[model samples]
Target: REMLVAEIEKRLPAWEKKTHLKCNGWQTKIMQNKWGSCNPAGKLWFNLHLAHTPIRCLDYVILHELLHLKVRHHNKDYIALLDKYMPFWQEVRKELNDFVLMPMK
Candidate 1:
């Protein structure tokens, strides 16, 4: 948990610097089918499953959600922002989706 928070703190500033978007708070919790989510109010929730993925994958999820703070939908502007910030996001996303973890008991 602490490691996740530290990773988030390290990445948040750089994204905020690039996009001028700010998040007030963030936390991690178990999620069934999503990597991360963000609200317009600047709060973020990252899936605990992310800890199992590569660090780059985690960063991709973080940037993906932070961009959501700016654009509410996955439209052209959102895609453009992602392309601009993380050009390899699609690859990372594919890698994330392809990764499968065993069901927790």
Candidate 2:
């Protein structure tokens, strides 16, 4: 958990410069059907499965939800935000889908 936070913090400047959004905090826990989730209030959660993913892929998920702090939902604004910060995000997403471990719901 601490290591993940450090990685996220290291990437924060890039996210801020590109998306101009802030993330309140982050946590890792078991989740069945989610890679990550975000709330309008700036909280973000990640599936513990991410601990097994490549660092770049984890960054993509973290950045994806952090961008949601500025634009909720997978609408144009959100996609645009992701595009600006992570051009290769779709590739990462695909890799995540292929490799993610599902937890009991």
Best by lDDT: 1
Alpha carbon lDDT at 12, candidate 2: 61
**Best candidate according to TM-score:** 1
lDDT of 1: 0.86
lDDT of 2 by residue, 7-88 (tens): 7667765766666677787677788888889876788888777777789888888788887787778999888878877888
Residue pairs of candidate 2 with colliding backbone atoms: none
Off by over 4 Å in 2: 1-5
Residue 60 accuracy (lDDT) in model 2: 88
lDDT of 1 by residue, 9-94 (tens): 88878878888888888888888878889977889999887878889998898889998888999999999999999999999999
